[model samples]
Target chain A: MTRNETVDVLIIGSGASGAAVAWSLAETRMNILCLEQGDWTRPTDFPANGRDWEARRYGDFAISPNERARVTDYPVNDADSPMKVANFNGVGGGTIFYTAHFPRLHPSDFRVRSLDGVASDWPIDYWALEPFFAENDRMMGVSGLAGDPGVPARDPPMPPIPLGRTGAAYARAMNRLGWHWWPSDTTVATTEYDGRAACINLGHCTPGCAQGAKASTDITYWPRALRAGVKLRPRCRVREITLNEHGMAAGAIYYDADGAECFQPAEMVILAANGIGTPRLLLNSASARCPDGLANSSGLVGRNLMLHPWPQVSGYVAETVDGGRGPMTSLWSKQFYETDPARDFVRGYTLQFARGAGPVAEAVDSLAAGRLPWGEGHHRAFRALLDHRLRIGIACEDLPEAHNRVTLDPELTDSDGIPAPKIDYRIGENTRRMMAHGIARATEIMEAAGATQIGVSPTLNSPGHLLGTARMGTDPEHSVVNPWGRCHDVRNLFIVDGSIWVTSGGVNPTSTIQALALYIADRIKQRLATLFDPG
Target chain B: METSQDSGLSALEIDALRRLAGVLIPPDAALAMPGADDPDILADLLATLGRDQARVQAALGALLAAGFAAAAPAEAETLARSRMATAGPEAGTLGRVILQCYYRDPRVLRALGQDPRPPFPGGHVLEQGDWSLLDPVRARTPFWRDDRAGAA
Candidate 1:
């Protein structure tokens, strides 16, 4: 296992996209080598208790303590940097810690520019990606309700999870207001669809799932790829993409398990290292042939970063709703998902009614709202409120802007001497207006649902669903990747992650990311001789 | 007991944190004993408890200040109760206080009769039936040194 092995295909970063690509290519008999930066650990390793889980899951040491020191670290601030780093490393990547809400983007989302003058339209339309989306949903075993008038109908592979009290209350409120809402489409299996157990509604999907219900890529696709003879090397951090004299990607240089430098040569390379890491890697791989960075022909290797903005509005009800009993978000409303002329903002928002909170999260919420920390006053308040709170989250679509971008800081570097991702972002006027509308609507819904008193936090920026750092387009001068996720500079170098998204849809991007990976793998398979053959 | 001077904490900051923690947990006055004089010792206790003591203190102080502002003629405790009641049970002021107490107070632990060696309840516990109850160990055994290297 020296640096001499030659593989047919080398994939960097074994997250949702990488895992899907590996699984799809495993059947092609290609010698595929997938590299993951974090160590491979199972769901059984997660802590059951709240306090320990909080420390292990939310702490900076979420990854292996050694590898954790090397990754990009950003501190949180209330004013400027409100983005909390909710990302995870390892085989499954962020999927292991996500809330598992898997909603596909509507057809209109692809034509945002045509519908409104806010954002640019994606080069590939919904019709081109519809089949791949279906395939991805089927492969992931999505549990959801079909025939909701508010959204496009796609027959789910499994039935939706049973609606709990929180869901019921939200549904009633929606019905009262005549708003469009439905059971959220999630990756959790409902009836043991694909050798995985169904969700038991543990309400702790933020950390790793203990019940194996959350369909993390490691559990769903990576295992299948391994069984099909794909070689997966966990704890392998890719440093740079080495190019040949002909200006094509030759192989990747990475740090092995023992922190030793190793290089693996391949005919073709795929970078699925997410929106943030993909751009960082590309920018860091500066060389003589590519002066600005690898695939920096357009000077757009790391630009136009987009994240779905989320602000929460919560309330208290009279009934005992055990808020911490089920999956984090089981129901969502798309009544305002599509853009309207009445609103000032070009993009719309989705209202998600989900389970309340864990004990720790609830405490944090109370503290944020200005409450006394302890004593008889604290005891009386806790007893009065423990079982009656109903929480709702509003997720607003943030349209991609040229100014909000990710660039490498010349000064700051990680422990491994890699440049830190310098994010120059501010909440645009359109997004702020959309958030205000969403918060007001959410507050009205809560009040109508017999809520005694409701509390709404001011607008906050969301760190989840990072997208569009290297946007896809038909032209090479304006975009980093083509419509098929192939780099314009290097034909064999493909990127399939949120980085390729042209617009941030008003929904979770995981399903779309997997669909894009599937589409790209299919393209590679069809053009195997032209792309991968060693003449 | 280390006083504020001994602990190197400003009297205002320590007093604020102590009052906030007391409000969060509202200890039974009968059971409430005089806290250690050393603010440093109290600060160490809070740090050992592993909770966000500063944020709790700041939030509690803001709430009290707001309540006092709203009802000038009303008692401080009554105003605090009214403000707490507005949050309701799941997210009410009292529940948050109890959570803070559970995190920052050794007195709460002593009342529960738990060992303070590991500090937390589920750390390194082997007999726990639930596999999820155990703390995450990075590498249980090295692959080269393990018995099931070939089997794995």
Candidate 2:
């Protein structure tokens, strides 16, 4: 085993949170190094560069790590979970394939327990992270209108991307229904900013943005972090976090790209591996001092897993909506975002109106649903469904449940022979009710939009927003991390990823996750003198 | 028809695919759109068959078991619908390969009114929807719960 030189700080996983924290801590001029298991994603190598772009979604650019299964990728044992794990292992992480639909959590989202009498309230509130959110928006170059009544009034950096035909139809429907709708805040640049070119409406943003319009962390933060002297070593798969005699995280033992074992010591360690990855690492690092896990004193290192359940309603309208012509998501509705006493479910869902699928996806999906038959009048069916379809995806808020957790799969191991994460998750009753309500409401909107045919997917297997595995709270007994992302059990160890999210809000979480990383980095800088004070 | 030796597909498998592709997507004279069984599309399908040979063969087996070749055109259509148009794994794999290859064809793409090229460098322009549509929504008072002023 090779023992490398020590550093002032070490960060694991160079995805959304890792890149943000690295950039934030760069100005401190500390010897900071981030170890990423995946390499940088070359924009030219993205699927959209070829005519087989849409087909690549099911292949190389698939959201599921198990499906993509590159050498750098690790398999996730998600067969037991209804909602499958969707993540990319590259430097930009999930953002590499994210549709870039950006939405910040509402003020009420922080106080879930206080407001709805369910789940635990976050130690920090939305107001505390508001400044960081704004900062992240600016850095990520969010594009949207200012006057959204669904959340706080904050103008984005660029004008909203054009609401193409599909968005227009949904907007008109929402207006007719007297529901609140706004042009969505997306990370895709509408006008050129920060050296990246504006979107040319190539339409396939999920499979990595070859156009460089989508704001993946690699394009937004990693470059700045690298320029600021943060040494980010890619393809170094961390095996475990080692502890000194006192149980403080000394550093990590990782496997280099050549499959050689190496140990790199550091003064402090931060885990930015997302919800599942963080817990898997902790569980795999079980030692005699901390038998359960490194930060498992609370017995909650891998508990309280929250995956936002997504249900969608798709339909076909008479007019051509230009299915694959613009950003995946251009407009959204927050009508059912908050709690209503009359409703069965407590927290509600965000209605994201997105364009329909590309030709290949639509055909495959429709055929699977038995909507498009393979004979006789197939042409008529194809024409009616192809470019005329639109979708309303309901991002349902899933509260934390102890039973839904991430454990190291005893049988499944990665290429490096490290145990993979086994997810045992199921949608809760509240989320199920919320999905039903969302489907009914979305059906109404589809009808209002003059949709001739409509279809409902009660639950989509795509669990892109993984949250709350290593929840942060004031109570150490019930949480893994403290309010500022410091580990409750280990003072020198910190987590600044979705794993620290107390609750999964009913929206895409990249924006909030990045803001929390920035907030944690700021807190770390503020308490530089007393950062490791065992208090 | 020239055999696709590189694809490793048998003459029987090629014939089976040729038979199935026609019923899967019949050509439209009115729209001037070629079906999945068009000479150009079938050739492309043969070349691409190597990638998904197992799944395609499985689907073909299912079709043959259902007596798709012996049935009348209408009966064959019914058999295909019942056997291939399903949520089953074999159906999914078959549908994906057939549709992916068919849609990527320049003739099929043009018939569908899509530009027959990759979706980059020559991206399409879209009309920005009317901003005035949000006037009614903007008129409503902010509905967010202000935590600073205390819980609602």
Candidate 3:
């Protein structure tokens, strides 16, 4: 294979964590290279630019890589998993399809073991990462109201997204029931922040934001990192991370866009591939020196997988809520976000309120739900739910379980002959109980909001929050990565992604994922003197 | 069960689709909303068949084989309901495509009080709601537990 010139730092995956760390380390003047498997996404090429925008969600912009099946996407064997793997392989990664409903993990989230006594506590607490959360928020241009009593008080860079008619309806319901509800901390800019424009109240925030308002890393950090002199080479699919005689990560071998095999050497390697991608790479890079995996001395590299179980409850209100006029989630409730001893479950869920879908989606989904008939009553049923429906999506916290893991498929391989990652996951009893409670609560709220008819999607299979496959902890014997995100076995290797999470919080993980990346970058800078010293 | 060369749909199949579409969603004179088999909507649906050609063809063939075209309007409706109850892959595809195309029509969108154009450059305006609704939530004390409040 071809050998490229060595760099000081080699990073893989240019999505949320990758982009943040690259930007953080750029000021050091060290040669930093990020190899991305997918090409850049142009805003004009987003689905919103076409009349068939809603339709494209099921096609090109599908959250599942198996369904999208782009050349850059590697097939995932999720047959054994009730919750399918949802991810994007492009420059922005899953952020490209995220709804931008950003919320930080509560302080209690880091102390799951201490508080609820379920999952292991994070090596680093929420206080350790609080500053990084603020820093990443500035870079990503967060929009939210301050003093949300659920978490700590902090001002966002921009005003909170407007609580339109739909949000107002839900807010009134919460007030009637005396439940806590707050405007969601969304990453979409309310006013023009940085160089991006403000959102125009477009119906669908996923399928890529044509408005340039949503903070996908491609439009958020990647541009700033590029300007800071971070070298990014796209369309280079990494096959394996190579190790030197000393068993340190020497570099990575990847296939370029032309399908030519080449090795990009570096002094240090950082993995920013998400939970599944990161573990898949580690397992595929196994060698005689480390037969199980590169950092498998603990045998925890691909263990403790957690995919948050999200259940959606929706119903039709009496009046027009104008559901197709704005971002999906403008408000959420932390009413059941913490532990309650009386409840059967340990950790709770966040109720994220969403506006209704557009005409096509509304018609299709309503028909399936039996709310809209297929005969003469179709028009009346469709008219009732066209713009009057509202939904509450419960983001249930998933405790880490060793059996719910990502393992290399024995037979399935990508086009490049790399073994695909197979997921074996089932909703645990705790999550099932949580979902039941959450559904009941959501139905109650909808009824209080004066919804005439209600529908429940008990479980959403594609939650897109892939986390905890390579957990971080203080103990090297139980975790794949140490507190500062360094592989316990590989001295010069580090990981900065959702894969390092110890527990899945009830809110969206993008905010915490970026904070962890920024925090790890700071730690790496601080320990530059003895960065490669053996543990 | 026949297939045309260009549109991947036979003339007979297109007629069958019209009959099936009417049974799927009939015209409503009260609201002036056209059915899925409206001439314009049927034309658009047929024109857009290339988007998901193989699946749509299979679905149409299945419906036609089930004698939906040969049956009376009431009998066709009964047959459609039974097929829908089963929700087989072919029935699902047919239902989804018809509804998707039906909702895209300007008349349908207008009747639903939505702008006919795509949600882009001409995005709609949403008036902000009462921010005082959050007063109660904001008045409450912080509920998050502090894990390291007294730590050095």
Task: Report the lDDT tens digits of candidate 2 across residue range A287-395.
Answer: 9999998899999988888888888788999999968888888788889999999998899989999898788888877776667877777778888889998888999
Error of 1 at A59 (Å): 2.2
i-RMS, each model, one decimal = 17.9, 1.3, 1.2
Between the candidate structures 1 and 3, which one is better when assessed by DockQ? Answer: 3
Interface RMSD of 3: 1.2
Ordering by DockQ: 3, 2, 1
Deviation in angstroms for A166 in model 3?
0.9
Model 3 residue pairs with clashes = none
| Candidate 3 residue-wise lDDT, A1-535, digit = tens | 9999999999999989999999999988899999999999998888888877776776677788886888889999998888887888989988898989899999889999888888898999888999999999999999998898887777899999888899899999999999999999999888998999999988789778899999999988998899999999999999999999988899999999999999999999999999999999999999998899889898988888888989889899989996778998778888899999999989899999999999888877787777888787778777788889988899999999999988999999887888999999889999999999999999999999999778886337657588998899878899989999999998899999999999999999999999999999999999898999977
The lDDT of each candidate is 0.68, 0.88, 0.88
DockQ, 0 to 1 scale, candidate 2? 0.72
Top model number, DockQ: 3
- The segments of candidate 3 whose C-alpha lies over 4 angstroms from its true place after superposition are B1-3, B10-13, B49-51, B150-152
The better candidate by lDDT, 1 or 2, is 2
Model 3's CAPRI class is medium
- Give the TM-score ranking, best first: 2, 3, 1
True contacts reproduced, candidate 1: 0.11
The deviation in Å at residue A239 for candidate 1 is: 1.4
